[model samples]
Target: MENVSVLEERKDFILYKQNGCSGNGMRCDANSVSGAVSQRACVYCGARVVLNPITDAFHIVHGPIGCASYTWDIRGSLSSGEDLYRNSFSTDLRESDIIFGGEKRLTAAIEEIATKHQPKLIFVYATCIVGVIGDDVDAVCKTMSKKYQIRVIPVKSPGFSGNKSVGYKMACNAIMELIKSEKPAKRKGVNILGDFNLAGEMWIIKDYLKRIGISVISGFTGDSNYENLLESPAATLNVVQCAGSSTYLANRMEEEMGIPFIKVSFFGIEDTTSSLIRIAEALQDEEARQKAIAFTKEETSKITPLVERYKKNLTGKKAAIYVGGGFKAISLIRQFDFLGVETVVVGTQTGKKEDYDIIESLVSKDTVILDDANPAELEKFMKEKQADILVGGVKERPLAYKLGIAFCDHNHERKHPLSGFDGMINFVKEINGSINNPVWKYMEESL
Candidate 1:
């Protein structure tokens, strides 16, 4: 809750003890301050990360090669069927193409991919260069779609358009365009939204749903394929996991298709249990609801002992959290609390007012809550708080180590699943190992 001096322009973006209680909300969902070296990604990167997980979709970045290269395999999304989404394709537009317009080159790229791969769907991303050059990507997509007799969707994601949140909306709009249909008869199933299946987390959640007698019609993008998405309209309800990326899609489906959505988080045991029960209740399935309760009880009993053992060593340690979405930050706060560790500092990239409100209520009054924080801000807060560990994405890993604080990877590129009952164990084990690692002691001794 202590106040720290920051750049004059970034003062409103950071929250601490005085302002945290003033009922003055944190500033978010806005463009990053100039020259702050903000950690937030661009609009094109956001759109690519959200849509590239569809197993069977062909993705083309209609701009320079660097845009495509940076976002290649952006999400650690595993596929059960097709691997086409893993390849980063681009028109490789050059000075000549930009000057003359890259429409023809884009058309050729789509034609080549369609001719060789014969894909069912394709997404063309417009980067800043394409936006500047006045390329009509939408018209090109329509012509190519008719020519190939396939769905060629243009993602209107220019990097200069807005921040990552805008890109999430753009990707959601593209998905809505791809899956729109005459109302289909509803079935006894749910569509999982917002989870990118990083580290096979989607598979883990699907298995739990199956055990509870609930069928998953589709995953929003993670491990989902063309067929899965095409059948999504038939689902009875939607359970949104990553609200940051998929909430807009859910809202569109509800408005256009009459499928209601409920936000759910599967990160920690507490949320996973509640979300499963809520899904069953939303479907009016009493039998499945009872099954969900039984599973929660069973899983909690099985995992609580192991977590308690780790807590013996971890209790009273403090943590700093900086993640992509508000839901993940909220879940991590609870997870750390369960382990008897206190979260002293927390921030999010795209969290809204409501998300921050929940976070504010959950953490202690002294806890620092920030939005769209840059590396300098994170380091200052973590150091001031004397955090024992920092839970964040790849971007923050080096920062944590350079400050001699233990680090945990809780982002998309992680190789381990961090959802459901199984994930609770993995998360606790990682936290215990990272915090108790011997290297920190050696560094201190040498210092």
Candidate 2:
């Protein structure tokens, strides 16, 4: 028999070792191994992903075109207002600017964007080059704000400084400053934090909350605009998802605005039911509690059958999961369990220690669990683990396809929402299509 083993692999220890993580013992928060094509994006990416859901805000990139180009409308946050947030704007920094300075170009670009869009606010983001060139974005934003009488917020998200979580904190800081500009009001509502409204996921959650008689003041950035964010301080409570990203915003809102925050997830049926109940219970409104129960019952019936059908097809297939946050990985493990699939390999880019604690417990022994994995590592581990399908974001998708393995996209770029009742069904369909495709037969024949 010809060696039927492209799957046979050497154990790349740094790439494969799940335990004895070097960073855990050492000062590991250093720039990731250079030239590894690390899946973790730049600091600007971290900041932008957290803030770009503000549909009316002009999210101007005050740096090279690459930064904006890579992230342009990559998320699926549905907007209820102006769609200005969808377009990516850049100073389009050139070689001359890199050697000289990009400040003037940035100022002109902002002025031009303002003239064209007349946006209520403009968030000017700084990149690695801008950080090095030392463009006074704050000074420029202040001058522009005064001249146009608009809010020009400067985001200090230099790519090299740290990771995506740091950028998320930066986004939260910008929102805090904006909320401070408006007068506070008594809140009859809560803000949904960390939901980017991808394919109307935020809307589904908002509808559920509304039916339960709880006023969702506004989603942090999902379908959110300047006016909605201005009212964020008024919300009595904050329910945060994707804690790796938005937990900072919720914490700051609580400290500065007197609004308490609760961590929640609305992924699988179990998580969605618990989260809905928790939010309703926190309100202490009986009507909300009753409404949540009805929503849960209705959705469970709708989704359970769909899950069962997929489970029947997906029963024995194993999966490899590499996501951005540990919370997502945690939820995915549960979701895979619901589908009767085993997760053979799992990892995250910006997961916390406590998050690792939860994930480690959920996974089986010898299941490779790593942190801040690069392409080489992901490729090696996925093959070594003999995973049938790989679930990850844009960067990881191609690798999976190249290897002739099935893939599921569970990232910001997805057009469909993967939250609540509808999401569960959609998730099933997507996975099923990929796993049981006619193309796989061709791939098998080629193999």
TM-score of each: 0.98, 0.92
Q: By lDDT, who's the top model here?
A: 1
lDDT of 1 at 327: 92
Task: Give the C-alpha miss distance for residue 93 in model 1, angstroms.
Answer: 1.0
The alpha-carbon lDDT assigned to residue 206 of candidate 2 equals: 86
lDDT of 1 by residue, 257-301 (tens): 989999999989899999999999999999999999999999999
lDDT of each: 0.91, 0.83
Check candidate 1 and list the clashing pairs: none
**Candidate 1, residue 3: CA error in Å?**
5.3
Can you tell me which runs of candidate 2 are displaced by over 4 Å? 1-30
What residue runs in model 1 are displaced by over 4 Å at the alpha carbon?
A: 1-3, 18-21
- Residue 222, candidate 1: alpha-carbon lDDT: 94
Worst 10 residues of 1 by lDDT: 15-24
